[model samples]
Target: MKRLLAAFLAVTLAVSAPIAAMAGSASLILDARTGKVLASENGDVLNHPASLTKMMTLYLTFEALNRGKITWDTPIVMSKYAASRPPTKLGVKAGGTITVREAVYGMIVKSANDAAAAVGETLAGSESNFARVMTQKARQLGMNRTAFYNASGLPDERQVTTARDMSTLGVALLKHYPREYRLFSMTAFTFRGKTIRGHNNLMVRYQGMDGIKTGYTNASGFNLVSAVRDGNRRVVGVVLGGRTARSRDAQMAALLDKYLGRASSGGRLLASVGAKQPVEVASAAADTDAPLAAAAPRSEGEAGNAPFALGYSDTATVPLERPAALEEMANAGKPQPSIRGWQIQISAAPSADAARALLAQAKSEGGTALKSATPYTEAFGTGANAIYRARFVGFDSEQAATAACEALKKRSYDCVLLANQG
Candidate 1:
């Protein structure tokens, strides 16, 4: 963490003490408990996000764990792709599996690129798919100024966000996933008997500091997402594009101190308490805004509505056909023989209760495949995550399914052929 404070400013014409100096850089420090902005510097200007991408990665993961889509104990299978991430990573080799509990640790403390990919793959079957899901969910969270191209915040011209948008994410993370959010406070994470200390200076040197994240790159400079709790009051701060590690941290400390005094000045920061009203969340219109696809109809007359996070501007309903459904496949006479090219071996939930979720895709597609869990949409505290499977069971030929899987993999799906005889 200290490294960033110095290295960041080496190239830039230095700014004086008592004030952070850097142009094209933006920052925000706010009251985490009260949601008040303390200091600001072009907080809304679009800039590269760097490793800050992982915060959302952790955010969506917490949601998955809470909803039972995954558990902390669940093992995350490392993939060749995940192992390919750049350094500042754990370097967990492909085919080695780590429990979700450990992956979070590796991500938080080590900032392991491998762990980020593992989490992305585990949730969406590929990082690309997960990135798609991330952007969709971000929009739903009212992150109008942001888009994510990957789980790791490597620079992408199109994958950009502003300080303001990140503040929304930072606060939402604390508000929505308190239990999981605390994991960010881990000053150090030990894995395989080795300790990887966190880079956030606040966790170690500052008072009331908790978990969040830090990001850096040639393009992004030094970025930190931080939260502090002083007594019953807590605040979140985002400092981006610092020229030096000390500058950023000191800047953060100074910013937080500045705001807290204002928040307590007259309790004016919380003055809007009575103005609060239920705000139905809506997504910033995509280039082409579209509405949620129609819910799938089951043979038993059940309506399976997948949670779609996209709130497009062009609301055009396809009135299209739901894809093949599992119930329909079972209802229709003889079970089709095993699909040759692509298939997913679905483990039925215990007591067969989880079958509907597993079969959600089949239900939505109008019974083309079998699902084991009830097909339901996953809603995090602040966003909706729809379950989407590009490859399901029962392809008639491996040649075609393999072709599709290959294509989907390029788009970030680690699709494998699942042979099901049952």
Candidate 2:
């Protein structure tokens, strides 16, 4: 009996060891300008990509746009299969349409699985074909160990990537499409009268960090690709197989902090690829401008109603409740309260009312983060060019203000911590 049991236990260990190895943590950091690997740990080990697969999906979309195969306004009609994708989706009905621009935002900010499927179909006639194209592009880009089976990066045993491959993709996006790359920095966007927010909270709060992507799934664990530009230095970092979203972000942040100072400066990644550095442009609309009509409600799932935070299951949406003091102040229509220590600005609007509207939206999404902070707006410029800065005040210290802004970013609200001049 002892001999038989020993043989059975050995067989069980052999079967499970490979599965455990596939889910282990991996990381990589690279200097974008010099194409130098600054740090790596199991960087080439294959692991499920989860939604980080959208990075390649967006890469192909940008390529098509650059090649004139599609335009930003091109309509992407949702098919039955696309619309039927599980939660964390845009919820467009079958035969319904969204512009290429909208689809891009849906994938980046909302991480909508349906949007990804529609874009894939539009580009390649089907998601499977798109996956083939994606893998081909991966080889061309030098990602030898990666394979993609779907565009949305949903659960697929056959789809896998590596930390080093993700960093390579991040650098490619920065180098080849400098203009469209700016979209990755967006924390939230107005979609059909509602704000579709993103889950990359670390990018919003991490100074110098711009855009990239995040992913999560039961099998893949938490994954992130981050790019940062500080002064003349630029670096791309990837972390995979984290136990939680917070831990994943923390790991990425630590990697950047450790290697950014060591990164070589004086050369731009886009310039090295002979790509023109496009001039940055600001949005022309005010915050209060009415958004387009919303699409159908998302399919039933806990993540559908929650802030789009990639793969975490605990980040459910909570109703906003204003503190009594804030309510009283709003009721009185009082002038900006004099009490202040530190402040945070969310955005600027064309009018005071517009600014106030922005403040309300921020508070609603910010939840308990901004509960103790006072809400107000301050005007700048003059005449038709005048703008009102939407702000929150009353934090007693810079640490307090920074903490609140970090929380707001986690909820997908743009935030900038500031010192109160008063």
Candidate 3:
């Protein structure tokens, strides 16, 4: 299991505790460059993901685009099931059609439930099957704690995720699909001569914050996953269970301010008293690693280089064609994990500092299960080109170590078990 001491240290030294209005909230901040966990609070606790579920729905749509299975111009017809969804929808009538490109903006800007279901049905033939596919994709991305019951993320006890999982998904979106990820920054979109505004204000309100998703439901409260880029560094932050949109936005803004700077304590633990690994944490760790890339600082109100911008036009602009290589990036050069006993291995980093940041992030994501595991930085290759791998010692049996990996994966941390080769 990994521990989250650095996050606690950064928060304690840099900011005050949350106000009463934000009680029982959960949040996480991650370094997009190195996949570091900067700060977290109740990040692993289960909560409904609400409209944030659209992020995954869009992810699969992007996957389709990359695979050439669906083009941006392909039309998706609305079924009654899709059109009947509640408010915050595109209001397409049953049998009406919208292009894949329109569905993408509808989901991002309007958080339209109808557009989500239509896209899902177009891809998987049914909403339920599409959800199953979503869950499968989540697991492949290491989102063990998350499950999708519907494309719309409508109220369902079974549709749940953690702040950690959402942050990981946010990182994956940018890392795996840079071209499609640009849609999140759109502040508004025009549909049938009417302009629909987006609910996520972070893009306009926060300087560095660019694009991501926001969610709200009575049971889920207000939730948001924000992606911010500063110079060569990028950070993804998640807030779940906010009392209101205002409080949630404030909580996330404060976290971004305090943890995104130089205050991070890389090796600190959240609590002095450590707990032993529990049985549940050992079984479930598997996921594709996120890419390491330096992002240029974003200009105010500008995210990606995509030509699409907010405001209604009588004619919608055609989406830019993504490079053919975009799809293969998801599975290219993926290193195989150790399969024998059960030690957890996160991604390799090009530098010691990055390895340490990843190590801190892993510990925070793993929590109690990894508290007892010793941290080790193993170097691979040599000289200036050497990459360091961050690893945690394993339990005596594969079952325990495997359990621990599973526990971390559910929270969307990169963890793969290795057999003890003694």
Candidate 4:
């Protein structure tokens, strides 16, 4: 069984001992550049995100990087509260201070609880405060159903997020901070001058796996939030609350190939993981509820780009003209009416401040940039997920997002466009 370390726990070091939960159901998703959902099953049921919450933590940290609040060389002190946290930690002493870069590695590659706690302490004076910040940012991202009780995503029933929500977070993180997102690709991290390999076996074994994170906790089950890139194509995905680490990793590997294609032939790869279980990570979702049950047959339409976001809780936003690709559901309910017209996201920054600052810079350079928040922020939080989107909405076709993205890239902002299903 390959290590399917939860991305949230990857930051926390998965330090806290998990109570252990039952095997989770399985689901899958594929996407296009337009922020669409291609496939999913049982995606929405508010399952545990486990350590995946740390992904938000990393996102926040990346934002700080943009504002120059802390540099890679900045040392993060290990507080007493941080030291007191559970296992899967870096075990930093009270007086011990690790560089921001080291702390990031410990969180992503090692999933050090101590590292995540340090970030919480360094960012907001305490984990509780940082969690508040996280929740606030989550609201900004339109993650209406999410609540962060802890930074480490230890099994608090309240620390719930859906797969759809997680996907939203993943997309935001990738698009919001392309430069910083590379940190997720680190195959191994060096801490205390000792190198530890990341638990994300896919990065080591698979291709185009830049990253995201993996997580687990007793209540959250084995979970994985991962992504893959193929030339001009890129996609972000998540699998939460599985029976075991092996099952989660296997399922994700299979899913990645299904969407991104096999390297040899550029076609979908064979399913390496045998029978998949149901997915339990609601937080894995970014926006709306999961699709029908995994047992429900996948619609031929679900495999195509349909502008939509998944959520750990639930909400649906689609343009009536172009429906979103089918994804698993986070909960049971009628799909909301699609919002008409195009939804455009022109720019993404490591943080809202940085994004705004960049927009200011753009305006000075004779360009138009607008900053707005989305429901996605409520679920994921500002930690780069609640990106400052600069766009021109109300276009006849949804291509405005793409047009804006192309225009922004000319000025050197790596951009992607997102739209709604009509």
Best by TM-score: 1
TM-score of candidate 2 relative to the true fold: 0.60
Model 2 Cα lDDT, one tens digit per residue, 1-422: 11111111100000001222276799999999887889999998989889999999999888767755567887777887788899799888887888889999998898989999887766644565457557656755777667777899999887888888888888889988989999999999988888888989999889999989999889899999999999999999999999999999999999999999999987767323222221111111112111111112223211111111112122222222222121122224334454447766654443454456546556655666677777775444344334445667778777777777777656534456655444
The list of candidate 2 runs beyond 4 A from truth reads 1-21, 270-422
Instruction: Tell me each candidate's TM-score.
Output: 0.61, 0.60, 0.59, 0.57
Off by over 4 Å in 4: 1-23, 30-32, 261-422
Q: Rank the candidates by TM-score, best first.
A: 1, 2, 3, 4
**lDDT at 407 for candidate 4?**
50
lDDT of 1 by residue, 9-91 (tens): 00000111222223257888766546566777887787777888898888888877676566688777777777777887887
- The order of the candidates by lDDT, greatest first, is 2, 3, 1, 4
lDDT for position 327 in model 3:
18
Model 3: lowest-lDDT 10 consecutive positions:
5-14
- 204: Cα error in model 2, Å: 1.2
Best by lDDT: 2
The lDDT, on a scale of 0 to 1, for candidate 3 is 0.64
Better of 1 and 4 by TM-score: 1
lDDT accuracy of residue 353 in candidate 4: 35
Query: Cα deviation in Å at residue 395, candidate 1?
Result: 23
